[model samples]
Target: MSKESRKFHVPDALANLYDFANTLDLRHFTHHGIQHQQADELHNLAALGEWMRQHGLIERAAAPSQKTFEAALRLRAAVRDYLKCEPAERHRKPAVIGPLNAAMEAFALRVATIGKDGFALRPVTSDAQAGLSAIVAELYDAASAGTLGRLKMCAADECQRVFFDRSKPGTRRWCQSTLCGNREKTRTYRERHRHDPASEV
Candidate 1:
């Protein structure tokens, strides 16, 4: 589990998937006179290797190839796209689901005898790229356990951050209600009252 996942109280089983999906931060909104900077943690093969190592998904010396790095980026993009859709409508949208299915083809996973259930999914390869497959396994497990639907992308266009929905009804829209959600509400309120004569100064 990464620091961000732990800080957010993400479930251990979905921690890796959560972290992998958040590799690219697309927040461009300014708050409190400070502009947020966009960042891609997997900027290159070296950075990818370091990220995997930090998450214990790869060895200290495992160097990812250029191809693997590209694949990782594609996977992240596909995941973000999928999360952008409504959970109930996700399956109905092939345009969003197809890319993720294609990106997952680069990595292979196999049944491993482990975990409390006496079985778990694991990567088949012995290379550093195998770490990517571990991420796939996490996705598969979460989906089967019916928890994958909770993973969602923020509705704020300026902050398309992926977040786990912990609401009882599982219908939360924004990642942070106090920030993104409030921003959206405030914007809507201003737009609604903009033409009202009674509100003119």
Candidate 2:
């Protein structure tokens, strides 16, 4: 669990998926005279391996190959694309779901007995790809538990950051109303009055 995940209060079950989906920060909006620089945590195989190890998804010595790195990038992109859609439309949108499903084919999980009566999803492999399967397992488990719907990408085009919607109505469009939401609202208000004669004076 990373600091960002904990700060956002993302549930433990979905933390990995949340973090993985947010590997690429698309927030390019300026705030308080500062521009938010976009960054991708998984910029390369070494970075991916470091991230996997940091998240305890893989062993410290486990290194991801170039192929695995490419697959991981695809998975991240597919996840972000899927999250960009409305929760209700996520399954219905083939343009998004197809790529996501295709990217997820590289990872696999299996049901395993946890304790007395509990069962949990475990990665089927022990190699570097297993770390990715762990992420897939999180997605599957969250979806089965219905918490997956709460995970969404910010509606702001400038800030396509993935966030967990904690609203009771679950209809939040922006990651933070005080920031992205307000910026959009302000922009819309300006556009609406842009051609108004009242402002011409």
The clash numbers for all candidates, in the given order, read 0, 0
Candidate 2 overall lDDT versus native: 0.92
Judge candidate 1 at residue 155 and give its lDDT. 98
**Candidate 1's residue-wise lDDT over 60-79, tens digit each?**
97888999999999999998
For candidate 2, the per-residue lDDT at 77 reads: 93
Best by TM-score: 2
Q: What would the TM-score be for candidate 2 when compared with the true structure? A: 0.97
* C-alpha TM-scores of all predictions: 0.96, 0.97
Candidate 2 weakest ten by summed lDDT: 56-65
Off by more than 4 A, model 1: 115-117
